[model samples]
Target: MAVFNPFLPSYQADPYPAYAALRAEDPVHFSAAIQAWVLTTHEDCERVLRDQETFSSSSDTASGQLATVLQQQRREFPLGEVPTVLNSDPPVHTRLRTLLNRAFTPRAIEGLRPHIEDIAASLLADAGRTGGRFDAVTGFAQPLPIIVIAELLGVPPEDRDQLKEWSTAIANTTNVLNTEDALAAARQATMELIAYMDEIVAQRRAAPGADIMTALVQAEEGGERLSHDELLAFSILLLLAGHETTTNLIGNGLLALTEHPEAAAGLRAEPDLLPSAVEEFLRYDSSVQGAVRFARETVEVRGRTIERGSTLLLLLGAANRDPAQFPEPDALDVARSPNRHLSFGRGVHFCLGAPLARLEGDVAFRALLDRFTELRVAEGGAERSGTLVLRGMGKLVLEV
Candidate 1:
């Protein structure tokens, strides 16, 4: 009877062992700690993701205690349960996603490569100037994505630090086991961020620019456009999704490389392996550990019946490492091909920022390897974030 306690420090530091145990003994089991049925198998998670009709993403569709808790939390949100791309299902999600997709065009993403490379080089240069040792989280990983996203969103450079603070506060509330204090801080941050974004949105509306923010503001399809509240929700979501996840990706990837010198050496020798290396990093330790979905109807899985409206915690990290789907799943192989990881999710709700994230990672890792000959973890190891939903290091000191 293995229990899932994600809040435990040990689990936060390393949850693969727990995921392995669950996948071996009970692939689909209910966990009282988070009050959700945890799905660990890659097949099970993939099925749920693909069958969005049966499993809804909206907090509104969520029933049982999960719905009750979400309702209470919504009351505190500045936008008040407005269905965004992340939480909504079907037609509403379809509409929102279509408009948002305008800003993330393939051309738009690829065009940012030069800018991303510049940002990475500048950050790494600053870190190098720090005389060989620096906190990678702050000096490199954290700021790289923040600056890139801020520029993408048309946010001014002076306001990025404040935005990062607000985004971090909001990210803390993503954890299922979040405390009252965290929720309170997140509420405050949300309110302030909305106010700040309202001004930017207004500016974009008045005068468009060559940026994603402008694209979002002007996005129209079949006589439908994002409402004011929807805009706010999207802007907030972009900041979180764009900044937080990639920050963790870079941090976690660097940590992994340092741990596996052979992999790092191989990557340096064959830089074309970068694309695959980034994918391997994503699979090895995903930035987003899990996602929540509610069963829209009674469903049978692994001889277990999940009642209608029951919440399911799809463990993406676990699924990535599931032995059945990935051969030698735990091994770090940068050149592994046909890698289909759930890090960007699947179906309608797949991460829209995937292109940008992948681009950023490619540039960041390349820049690091090109500039610094050696990258070693500092005296103390990574300080892992407490949030269970998102996995990342808050601080990772590095010696180059």
Candidate 2:
């Protein structure tokens, strides 16, 4: 009998080997600790994502104790009645996604490129002002997304720090509910976040601005628009989804570059490779590593039967390194084309902030490489974010 416990120090430092073994030996094994069936291979993961009918994103499909847990989550938090885009299924998911697409249009994201560059450049300049040594997490990666999302939502500049605080507290609560302190903090954050967004919604109504938040407030489809609670939930979701994950992406990408000098130098020498490099970073160390879905009904998969209401942990990190999907899958190849990793996941639930995240990564990496010739991990090593669902560092101190 084999198992994958992400809590193990060895796995936290590097889960690739364990993931490889699982892909080869136990593609569809059960982890007793999580009490869920784990899917490791690229094929199985993709199959589960594509066939949402059998595996629903909505927890309403769950039964028994799983349903109890879902109820407990809502009881503990103030997320309102409507589901955010992340944990929903069609036609609820379909409607929310349709409206979301209008708000996160390609044209809007493309326009942010220049602004992203400016933000990245300014941060790098501040870091390099008194020579090159800064906490990448606090100095650059974290604030970039916070500032970007705040501006996009028409949030005042004075409130970015508070927004970051609430977003971080909420992100910490994902896939973790056993602890009293964590859940309490999450509930507090949720209440505050909702209240804060509620104020923004009111302000927008009074005098709409030229920003995405205003657009979402006024967006109508067949005379359909978000209600009071839906508007607040959407704003909170957009802030958390856009802010926390991309910060991790930037931090993780920089950490990868620090560890792999040759690849970093290559990226600097050939800046054209930044886009491909971003994908490789995502594959190598995804920000959101895995997601949970409830089994709509009992279904046999890869010779095992998953019962209804059973939790399914789709290992996006493991699937990205499945040898069947890539040559030398463990190796970080910035130039690896045809790279289709499930970091942001697949299907209708794919990350809406993917383009914005990629743009931020491209800008951040190029600016870092161009500004500093030498880059290495600083003292105290790196802290692994202790969450089952999201894989990222707490802080990445760098010497340049």
Candidate 3:
């Protein structure tokens, strides 16, 4: 029988096989260990994402282990409990998204391309100074996105490192099954981050700047502005979600290219394929492996009756690989056309930072390939992130 245990080391190493097993035998299976129903097929996952009324995004609707974690988080760190776009639905979510859209417009994002390209070049140049060997996670992947997001949020460049540290702490608690120690650390980090954001927001209000923070502070839709708590929550969410996923994308994409040299070579040969390659990278190994939702009412999925209030784990990584959606899902094809992968998810909560991430990935990959003639994994194996939901590398040494 196939098991849906995400905590297993083997599963962390490569979850696609296990995902494949569950999709074939039991697409909608409940795992007692995690205390949630796991959905593997693309269609079923899409159905849940699209029908927000039936599957809620709010912690108030969560059940079982998810509720326990959320309750404790709220009690211990109320700052993290605010109804931001990530955890809110409909009216609340609609308002938050609308305001955010005004601040994070496409033109604003597009304007950052030249800056992103410069940052990627600078990071690679610094790597070259390190005698041809460096930990890509720290030296290249992590800093590139951190710098970009920090500048966008009006954070000074020097404090980017500290911001990343706090962000990582908060992200550790993404999975409800995390250790108490992890939760405690995350709580402390949440407090510190909120305090810092409060100060920044005040500064932005006092003297507006050409940054996302200033735009957010000034943004108004129908004469409705974000409340103080809403502002803080949205800022915190942006900082956390903005860079972390893209960091993982770059790291994971690099690893994928390293494992499949032919794809890397192909990209180097035909530079126009970078965007398509980035899409494949997102599909093959997503930064966010899955997302959490609550069953608002009893719903039948693939003959399985999911009771109201039950927590559901929509396995996005698995869904992206479902043969019903993508042919030969296991194989990595850079030029896969009509690739409608759910790496950024679907429906109302689809990733807001998708374009930014794609741009960063394109720039990072192009810069790396153009600068270095060869790329190889170092002797020591890479270290994967502790959390299951936000999957990525902790440390991956590379030689160029």
Candidate 3 error regions (>4 Å)? none
Residue-pair clashes, model 3:
0
lDDT by residue (tens digit), candidate 1, 224-249: 89999999999899999999999999
- In model 1, what lDDT does residue 113 have? 94
Question: What tens digits encode model 2's per-residue C-alpha lDDT throughout 153-260?
Answer: 888899999989888787766654347787778789889888878888899999999888888888878878877887888888888878878888888888888888
- What is the lDDT of every predicted structure here? 0.89, 0.82, 0.87
Candidate 1, position 263, lDDT: 91
**Which 10-residue window in model 2 sums to the lowest lDDT?**
61-70
- Give per-residue CA lDDT, model 3, range 177-259, as digits (tens): 67888888988888888888899999999999999889989999999998999998887788778878988998899889889
Q: Please rank every candidate by lDDT, starting with the best.
A: 1, 3, 2
Angstrom error of the Cα, residue 185, model 3: value is 1.4
Comparing 2 with 3 on TM-score, the higher-scoring candidate is: 3
lDDT, residue 178, candidate 1: 73
